[model samples]
Target: MDLNKIHNIYFIGIGGIGMSAIARYFSANGKKVAGYDKVKTPITNSLEELGIRVHFEDGVKHIDLAFLNKEKTIVVYTPAVPSDHQELTYFKNNAYTVLKRSEILGEITKNTFCLGVAGTHGKTTTSAILGHIMEPLKATSFLGGISENYNSNLILGDDKVSVVEADEFDRSFLRLSPNIACITSMDPDHLDIYDKPDALQESFKEFAGKVTDTLIVAEGLPLEGLTYGFGDSAAYQALNIEIKNGGYFFHVKTPTRLIKEIEFYLPGRHNLMNALAAFAIADVYGVSSDVIKKQLASFKGVKRRFSYKVKSEKIVLIDDYAHHPTEIKAVEASVREMYPGKKVLAVFQPHLFSRTRDFIEDFANSLSKFDEVLLLDIYPARELPIKGVTSGWLMEKMTLQNRKLISKVNLSEEVLKSEADVVVMIGAGDIGLMVDDVKFRLEEKFSLLK
Candidate 1:
């Protein structure tokens, strides 16, 4: 399908991070853009502010008349949307040119020099960093999270190059034809879709095969590529890492050159690795080491990827989108490294039932690293609840002595009771939406004590 021939673009789940990026892309390119989401959000609000039509209801009437013309309009929907969704069904039954979010992205970037960042974790940060590094070259980046530097997911650039989060959900990355790509990890996730760890690994290998120019992999991953990590044997290695002034200062050894004293502000060894990946990709694309170092230093980071909501001498409040066991462990390590000798409280909401059931023990063990734990019910983003799988069950498996199963209704009250010096809210669901309320209450209560 020729996107140039299309005049109106509609999305069934336009409020999603990825979907909204595409919506903004079309809107910026002068296409009549609109969509339907199950609910209104800050993302939907932003779209409305751009003069794009958005409505929460699922009826066909909510769609503007311009979008009803099948010849000129193409519909895009996320895999997370229900199969029976009214707007999606209407578009399909009406024989509109419908495509998945990945398909549309594939179409947009197929002809460009696409730098696809693929993995279970770190995709968002890695892609955002790459986008920032490549901004001088006019690379359009469609990121999975809000870049703190740009304040928007869509980093609008020219048509010659594109940066994208090569997602593995539903094997969506398979649709993209990339000139260069990197696999940050091959961790087993989305068990509801893959059902087996090997299947997920196979998908990564398939994506790696699609990279036409270069494939960069994290050190110790199963894929064979120009490796990047802290180890001496990796092609792109971050050596002599040190933490100072709330950030990392390190030297990177590329295949051809040694980039020295690169300063990165994002906390965590995992994030250091993410920076390394971005640096490797940009270096391969012929960006100067000095330019990559400058961009990495300037990149603020993606929102909710260890975002500091409240920070002071008395208390520190952090919000992160770490629903996976490995991600939680990374967050825990970063917190412990940043604030030693401080009592830490972790409030977690599991993301999906299949994921919770598949990795319950792992989740419990990871959360146990905190001094205190508050477990909320599973978010169940796209899956029905499984019998006997719940937060209470997860709480029982945790080794933490100070752990409680709490509800959102009483989140602020329970959090206020904690004597912990650091409070971290971790999840990928509406719990993110609840952080402002929790932050407000925490500030109010703590100020009274002062």
Candidate 2:
């Protein structure tokens, strides 16, 4: 679809991170923008402040009459939205030029130099770090999560280059045409859609084939591409890693030269690998090694990916969007590495019912790594609850003795009652909404102790 003819863009689920990025893109380009979300969030509020109309109601009346014209208006919706959504149905029945959020993103990046970062894990951080590296080139980044450095998911810049998190959910990344693509990891996830792990891997292989230019794969991903990891022999690698002042000071071996003493603020070996993938993309794009190192040091992480809420000595609280087993394992390893011998408490809210059922054993094993575990009822973002697949079921499978199923109402209280030195809230669901409450209560409790 030729975008020039479209005058107005209406979003059915604009509050979503990816949808909002595209909404901002259209609004910035002088198109009349408005959207309907089931709930209003800080992201939707930000859009409203930008002169874009946002309504929380899911009714068709909330949509302005100006967008009712099928000829001049374009409709975009997230796959998360139900098929029976009134506003979405109205657009479809009226023959409006409706497109999925990914389709719109594909259209936007088709003519530009697109850099896509894809994986079951680490895609957001990799894309964010890559965006930082390509800042000198003024690349527009449509991130899956808000970057702490940019404070927004959409990084507006010239159309010379675009950086995006190629989401594997619903195989949405297939729509993108990237000049340089990086696959951070191809872990099995979203089993509800893929039905099996092999299907997910095949989808990734197909995605690998779509890379218009260079394809950078993480080490050991069964695909043909230049690899990046801690291994010295990898095409791009981070070696001789040392911890200084709670940050990683490491040397990266590029194909041409060995870049030394790069400073990275984030924790976890997984993050070092994420930075390596981004560095490889920068190198492939001909960004100088010195500039990559400099930009990487200043690159702050994404909002909820291992975000530190309280970093004091008395009580440490961190929040992360780690619903997957591998991601939770990464978070646990980072916490243990940073505060060795400390009693770590992990509060996890399972994201989807199918996911909970698919990786029950893996989830139990990962959560058991913590000293104590608090499990919240499944978040059920886009799935109906699977019978017998509850948090209690998961808790029972866990090897840890100090584990209990808790509700959001009792989340902070349970954390305060635990004898843990470090608290980490891990999930991709509404558990993030409780971070401030948990942090405030923990702070108050620690202050009273002092």
TM-score of each: 0.98, 0.98
Model 1: per-residue Cα lDDT over 310-369, one tens digit each: 888878899999999999999999999999889999999999988898999999899999
* lDDT of the structure predicted as candidate 1: 0.93
List ranges where model 1 is wrong by over 4 Å: 448-450
Steric clash pairs (candidate 1) = none
Q: TM-score for candidate 2, please give it.
A: 0.98
lDDT of 2 by residue, 290-361 (tens): 898889899889999999999988889999999899999999999999999999999999999988998999
What is the C-alpha local distance difference test score of each model?
0.93, 0.91
Candidate 2: pairs in clash: none
Error at 261, model 1, angstroms: 1.3
